[model samples]
Target chain A: MSTKPASERATPWALVTPALLWTLCFFVLPFAAMALTSVTAKDGSFTLSNYAQFFENPSYWRAMVNSLQVTAIVTVVSVLLAYPLAWILAEQVPERFQRLALMLAVLPFWTSYVVRSYSWLLVLAQNGVVNRVLTGSGLFADPVQLANTRLATVIGFVHFFVMLLTLTIFANLKQLSPSYRKAAADLGAGPVRTFIHVILPLTLPGIVVGAFLTFVLAIGDYITPQILGGNNELLMPQLIMMQIGRRGDFPLASALAIILMAVVTVAYLASARWLKIERA
Target chain B: MRAFAKILATVYALLLYGFIFLPVVVLVLFSLQATQFPIPPFTGPSTRWYAAVLADTRLTTGLLHSILVAVGSSLVAVTLGFLSAWGFARFYLPGSAFLRGLITLPLTVSYLIIGMGLLVLFNRVGIPKSLAAAGIGHVVVNLPLCFAIIYSQMGDHQINIERAARDLGASEWKVLLLVTVPVMAPAIFASFFLSMTFSWDEFVISFLLTRFETTLPVEIWNLLRSGLNPKTNAVGSLVFGVSIVLVVAFELLLFRRKQS
Candidate 1:
C-alpha cells in the first residue's frame, strides 16, 4: 500500500472519528464515571465506604462466592460436554457433513439469549418437561422442583453456552494437523492417550479462550439468574441490579460493578497468559 | 474401524443437533399445549396464547421498534466498519495493529458494563437516553465485528486487484466503487445480517437506555418479570421462526455459491 499525502491523511481519521468518539463517550468515559461514583459518598464526600461495605458484608461476600461457584461449574461442564462433541466433529466426521455440523453448533448462538433462558425456565419449572418425564417414567411420584434452584441455573448456563464453546474448540481443532494424531496412533497409543498427550496440549489455547469467554459471560449474566435462580441463588449481577433498581443505591452498584470489572480483568489476564503459553 | 467411528460420529452429531433444537421444540410444543403447566401430558393443541400475543399492542410496537433499531444500527455499523477496514487494508497507517486490537476489544467487555457505561455517558452529555442512544450504543458494540469480517475478506488478492485498477488511472473512489466493493459483497452482506441479528436480539443496553420505546428483548424481559405466560412463547416462536428461515436461506445460498 502507498502512503497518502498529508491532506489525504485526514480521510482515514474522518472515517474513524465517529466510531472513536462513540467508544470514548460511551465506553471509556462511563466506566471512569462509574468508578468516580463508586468512591463518592452520599453526603458528597470522597470515601471508601462502598468498597468497605462490599468487603465487610457477609451477604456481598456470599453473592461473590456463589457467582464464582456457579461460573466455575458452568465453565467446567460446558468444556466437558463441548470437547467430546468438538472432537467428534473435527476428527471423525466426513468432509461433506462438516458444514452442517458446524451450522448446528452455531445455531443456538443465533437465538435470543433471554428467550433461550426462558425456555429453560419452562423446561425446569416444577411442572416442566424434566419432571414430567421423571414422573411419567415412574422415576418419581411427583414433579421435581427444578426451577429457581442452583441446579436449574447451572443447567441453563450450560445449555445456552456449550454450543459456543464447541464451535470455538472445533475451530481450533480444524487448524491442527492430522499427522500428529496419526503418528500417535501408529505408535500404538490409544485414543485416550492420544487425546491427552497430543490433541489436548495443542488445543489448550482454544480451551483457555473458550473457558474465559464462558466464565466472563456466565458471571456477567443478570437475566439468566434473575429468571432461573430462586431466592437462594442470587449472583453478583443480580445483586448489582437490586442495588440499582430496588434500593436506588447507584454508589453501591457502581462499586460492585468496579469489583466485577476487576475480577473479570484479572481472570482475562490469567487466561491470556495461558493462551500465549499454549500458542508458544 | 472406520465404519464404527463414522457411526459414533453420526450419533454425536445427532445428539449435538438435539441439544440445539430441544428447547425450541419444547417451546413450540408447549405453546400449543392446553395445560397451563409445562408437563408433557398434553391435553390438546390450542392457539389461544397466539391470539393473546397478537392482541398485545405493546409487544407488537416493541417488535417494530426493534426492527427499526436493528436496521438503523446495522447500516451505521457496516458503513463505519467498511471505511475503517478500507483504511487498514489500503493504507500504511501508523499504529494499525493497536487500532485493530482496540476495535476488537469491545467483544471482551460484558454487555452489562457496556450498558452502564453508555447510560452514564449519555446522561452526562445530555443525550437523553432514547432509541437513538440505544442505536448508537449497539453500533459501537457491533462495529468491531463488522470491521473484523470486512477486514478478513479484503484479502491480498482483492487488495492487489484494487491497486492495479488504481494504477491504471482509476481514482481511489472509483476503484473502491467498481472493483473492491463488489469483491467484498458476500462479507458485507453477511456482516449486515449478523449485525441486524445482534442489534435485534440485544437486551441489556436497550433495557438500560430506553424509557418509552423499548426493543423486543426489553419488552420480553418486562413481560417475563411481570409473569410467565404462554403469550411470551408465541412471540418467541415468531422471532425464532423468522430467524430460522433467514439463516436457512442464507446457508443454502452460500452453499450453492460455494459449490458452483
Candidate 2:
C-alpha cells in the first residue's frame, strides 16, 4: 500500500488518535495506577506489606494455590471432553450437518454466564435431579453434597469451557488437509496411531491456545466461584473483590489483581509460541 | 463393526448434549414451579413467579440500565475501534505494528483485573461510581474485540475501491463515510452486535463499578444472594429467551447475508 506523500500522514494519525487515547487512558493508565496503588500503603506511604500479606497469610496464599489447581483441572477436563467431541463433529459427522450439530452443542452458552452458574447450583443441589437419580436408582441412601463445593465449581467451569475448546479444536481439525490423514493411513498407521502421532500433534496449537484461554478466564472469574463454591474456600478473584467490597481496601485489591494478572501473564508466556489471534 | 461404532458415536453425542442442556432444563422447568422449592416432585406449572419478576421495580430498572450501558458502550467501542482499524490499515505509520499490538493487549487480561484496576484508578481520581463508570469499563473490555474484527476485514480489495472513490474528488471523510462504511458494514454490524451481547451479559465490571443502579446480571446476582427463589429462575429464563431470539435473528439475517 502506497501512502500519500504529505497531508495524509497527519490524517491517519488523526484517525487513530481517539482509539489510542481511549486505550491509553482507560486500559494502560488504569494498569499503571493499579501497579502504583499496589505498592503504596493505606497511610499513603510506600510499603511492601501488601505483597507480604499474600505470602505471610496462609489463607491468602491458599487462594492463589486454589485458583491454580482449579484452573488446571478445568482446563484439562474441558480439553479432554471437548477434543473427542470436536473429532466426532469434524470427521464422523457428515460435513453438511456439522454446523447444526456444533451450534446445538454450544447453544446453551447464549444464556447469561452468571445464570448458568446459578443453574448448575440448582441441578447439583441435594434435592436436585442428580441426587434424585442416584437415590431413585438405589445407589445411595442419601444425597451426596454436590452444590457449593469445589466439584460444583469445576462442573460449571468445564461446562462452559467445553463449548469453547470444541469450537477452537473443531476449527483446527477442519483446517487439516485430507492428504495428511490419507498419508498416515497409507504409512501403515491405524486410526489410533494416526491420531496420536499425526493429527494430535498438528492440533496441539489449538489445544494449547484454548487451554491457555480457559486458564486465564477461569482464574479471573468471580461469579463461578462465588455462587458455586459457597465461600468454603476463596479464589484469587473473590479475595480481591472482598478487599474492595467489604473492607474498602483498594490497595490490597489492586495488589491481588496484579498478582492474578501476573499468573495469567506467566501462562501466556508458557503458551505464547502456539497462541495467535488470526485463524489458521 | 461400523454399525457398532455409529451407535457408540450417537450415544456419546447424546450424553454430551444432555450434560450441556441439563442445567438450562432445570432452570426453565423450576421457573414454572408453583411451590417454593426449586427441586423434587415437579409441581403445578404456574406463571406466578414470572409475574413476580416482571413486577419487581429494581429488576425492571436494572434491565433498562443494562440496555443503556450495552448500547452506549458498544457504540463507543465500535466507533473508536473502526476509526483506528481504518487508520492502521490505510497508513504506514512508524511502529504501526507495535501500536496495533498495544490496542489489542487487553484481550488477554481478565475482566476482574480490568475492573479492579479501574476501581482503584477511579478512587484515586475521586470519580464516583455510576452507570457511566460501568459503561466506561465496558468500553475498555469491548474495544479490543471490535478492533480485531474490523481490522481483519479490511482487505486490499476494499482499499482499492476506497482509493477510486477518493480519486473522484471525494474528501477523506466523504470516501470513508460513503464507500468504506458500506463495504465494511457486515464486519461493523457483526462486531457491534457481538459487543452488545457481551456487554449486556457482562457481570463483574458492572458489579464492581456501579452503585445502587446497575445492570441486570448484577441485580440478578443480588437477588440470588438474598435467597434461592423461583424469581431468580424466572429472570434467568427471561434472559435466556431474549438472548436466544436475538441470536437466531442474527443468524437468519446478518450471518446469512455474509454466507451468500
Candidate 3:
C-alpha cells in the first residue's frame, strides 16, 4: 500500500484533506480542549480536582451505575422484542411488505428525538393515554404514575432503539440460507432445536452488534432522560449537562464526559471482542 | 407447522410496527387537540394552534435560519466530502484506514460533547457563538457521513477508470472532473440529501452554539420547556411533514433510476 509514487500518494491525501481538516479542527481539537479542561482547576492551574470530585462522590458513581443499568435493561428488552420481529420480517413476510415494514421501522428515527421523547411524556403522564385507556377499560383501578420513573426512561430507550436492533438482525437473517433450516428438519431436528442450534448461533453477531449499538446510544442519551425522567432521574449524561450548562462547572463536566467516553469505549471494545468470538 | 410460525410472525410484526408508529400517531393527533395536555378528553379538532404557530415571528425566523444553516452546511460538507472521497479512491495513500477511523470518530462521541468541545474551541479563538459558528459546527459533524457515503459508492472501479482516463491523455484534474465525478453522481446526490437531513434535524449543537439566531428544533425546545402549546405541535407537524415529503421524493427518484 505504501509503494505508490509520490504523485499517486498526493491524490489520496488531497481527497482526504478536507475531511481530515474538518475532523482535526472540530473533532480532535475540541476533544483535546475538553481533556485539558477536565484536568484544569478553578485557580487556572492543572489539577486532578475534577477527577477527584467525580471519583470521590457517591452520587456521581450512582449516576454511572444507573446509566449502565438502564442501558442494559433497554438492550435486553430491545433484543427480546426485536429478534422475533427481525425473524418475521426476514423470513415470513413477502418482499413488498418487507420493504414497507422496514421503512416503518426506520421512519420514527427521522423525526426529532426531542419530539419523540415529549410524545412519551404525553403518553406516560399520570392522566396520559395509557393510564386513561387502562382505567377506562377497567384494566387498572387507578392511573399509574409512570412518568419520571426509571421504568419510563427504560421504556423510552427501548422504544427509540428497538427499530435499529430489528433492522440489524433482519439484515443478518436475510443472508442465511433457508436450505439450512430445511436440512435441519430433514435430519430430525424440530423447529425449536433447529432455531436454537442453527439460527441462534448464526444471528449472534447481529445480536451483539445490535445490543452494543443500543447500549451505546442509550448510555450517551441526554434528551430522553431530561424530558422523560422529570425531576427524579439523574443519569450520567444529564449530570454532565447540568455540570456544564446549569452549574457552569466546565472542569467537572469535562471530567464527567471523559468518564462517559471511557465507559462507552470499554463497552464497545468488549462488544467488538464478543463479535470476534461469535464469528470464530 | 408453518401455520403456527406464520401466525406468530404476523403477531410479532404487528406489535413491532405498533411500537414504532405509536408515538408518531400520538404526535399527529395531539397536534390537533384543543387541550394543552397531550391526553385528550376530546374538545374537538381545530387549526387554532397552527394559526398561532404561523403568527409567531420568532418561530418563523428560527425556521428560516434553520433552513439557511442546513442548506449552507450540507452544501459545503457534501462538496468537500465528494472531493475528498474522489482523492482517496483515485490516489493510493498510506494511512487511509487511520484516516477513515478519524473521520468516523465524531459519530461515536455524544453530540453534547461535540457541542461542548466546539464551544470551548470557539471561546479560545475569540469567536462569539452565533449562527455562522453553529453552521460550521454542523458541517464538522456531517462531513464524515457525507465522505463515507461518497467514498463507498466510488468503489474499486473508480481507480481503474481514473487510471484509464489519465493513460488516454487526460489531465489529472480532467480525469477527476470527467471520469471520476460523473460515475459517482448518485452517491454524491445521496450524500447531499443525507447531510441535508442531518443538518436540518440536528438540535444539540445549534441549541448550544446559538444565542439570538436559533434553529427550528431549538425554538421547539424552548416552547416545549416554557409551556405545552398547540403552536409547538403545529410546528412539529409541519417539520415532520416536510421531512417525510423530502424523503419520499428522494426515494422515488432513486427507485425510478433503478428501474430505468
lDDT of 1 by residue, B141-253 (tens): 89999999998888787867887897899977788789977898999999999999889999988988899988999988888875556777778887888788889998888
Pairs that clash in candidate 3: A15-B84
Candidate DockQ values, in order, are: 0.59, 0.86, 0.65
Residue B73 of candidate 3: its Cα lDDT?
Answer: 94
Candidate 1 - CAPRI tier?
Answer: medium
- Judging by TM-score against the true structure, name the best candidate: 2
Quick one: best lDDT, which candidate? Answer: 2
Off by over 4 Å in 2: A1-7, A274-280
Query: True-contact fraction for model 2?
Result: 0.83
Pairs of colliding residues, candidate 2: none
Give the candidates in order of DockQ, highest first.
2, 3, 1
Clashes of each: 0, 0, 1
lDDT of candidate 1 at residue A18, scale 0 to 100: 70
Per-residue lDDT tens digits for candidate 2, residues B75-160, read 99999999999999987779999999999988989998888888888988999999999999999989999999999999999988
Judge candidate 1 at residue B80 and give its lDDT. Answer: 81
List model 2 lDDT by residue over A26-128, tens digit each.
Answer: 9999999999998998678998889888999999999999999999999999999999889899989988899889988888899999999999988898888
Off by over 4 Å in 1: A1-5, B1-19, B34-39
